[model samples]
Target: MNILFIEDDMIESMKFQRTLSKIASRHTIIEAKNGEQAIDALKNSESLPDIILLDLNMPRMSGIEFLQILKADEQYKYIPTIILTTSENRADLLECYRIGIAGYVIKPLKYEDYEQKLTAVLAYWQTNELVKA
Candidate 1:
């Protein structure tokens, strides 16, 4: 699976990368520090990502803003995006769902728990069929 992981935190991003390596070694993860960078990555890539693992909070374009842009674009709207965020706020969750996120995952504090959740998420998406552009 080709995954575009949008996150700003270096430590958290590194941790997620490690966990992803363990759970889905064959999958390729393309990292983007913010929403703008993500858009640039998408534009430069020959093929679109199979899914996007987005972080709700970031420096420049917040995940919500990014979602609005992505969902509005007919060419990219079909790509499934899942939120991998630390925010547990109800408003964030509701808003992400409203914007058409495939799933909203709260990052677990414990490393083991985080790994487990990430593993399950990757496994589910791996088997699921994605919409073709």
Candidate 2:
């Protein structure tokens, strides 16, 4: 699966990328250091990703801002977007839902838990695709 990962924290992004590398055979993980970069990447790419894992806090443009722009545009709004952030605030979760996020996952401190969450997200996407087919 192709994935768009928008996380400002470099270390966290690398960890997530490595974990995903183990499971996906034909995966392409697009990296965006910030929301602005994410938007630029999306615009330039010929194909959109199957899933986008967004972070809440970022420089220049926050995930919330990006989601607003992403969802407002008819061409990009249908793509599945999930919030995967360190923030576990109820307000953040509610806001994500309000913006039509596909899923919300809190960043786990444990590697095992992180893998489980990633697996679940991947499975959900796969199931959704099968249903559509």
Candidate 3:
């Protein structure tokens, strides 16, 4: 599975990477620090990502803004984007769903719990049939 992981925090990114390596090393990840960077990555990619894992908060452009842009664009609108965020706010969840996010995952405090959630997310997406760009 090809994943585009848009996260600004280095530590959080590292933790997710570690968990992913343990769960599925065969999957490839494209890292983007912010919404702007993510847009650039998508524009330049030889092939689009199978799924997008986005952080809700970041510098420059927020995930909601990014989602608006992504969904508006014809070429990128079909990609399944999951919100992988620390924010547990109900408003955020509702807004993400309104903006047509595939899923919203709150980052658990416990490392073990985080790993479990991530593992399940990855497993489901990896096995699901994804339409090519």
Clashing pairs in 1: none
- Give TM-scores for every candidate, taking all chains together and pairing residue i with residue i: 0.95, 0.92, 0.96
Worst 10 residues of 2 by lDDT: 124-133
- Order candidates by lDDT, high to low: 3, 1, 2
Candidate 3, residues 1-133, lDDT tens digits: the string is 8899999999899998999879744888999999999999999999999999999999999999999999989999989999999999999999999988999999999999999999999888877877332
Tell me which of candidates 1 and 3 scores higher on lDDT.
3
Task: Write the residue-wise lDDT of candidate 1 on 44-100 in tens digits.
Answer: 999899999999999899999999999999989989999999999999999999999
Instruction: Report how far off residue 15 is in candidate 1 (Å).
Output: 0.8
lDDT of 2 by residue, 1-133 (tens): 7789999998888778778777755567899988899999999999888889899999999999999999998978988999989898899889889998888999899988998898888878866963244
Candidate 3 backbone collisions, by pair: none
What local distance difference test score does each model get?
A: 0.91, 0.86, 0.92
TM-score of 3: 0.96
Tell me, what's the RMSD of every candidate?
1.5, 1.7, 1.4
Candidate 2 TM-score over all chains jointly: 0.92
Candidate 2 vs candidate 3: the TM-score winner is: 3
Per-residue error for 53 in candidate 2, Å, reads 0.6
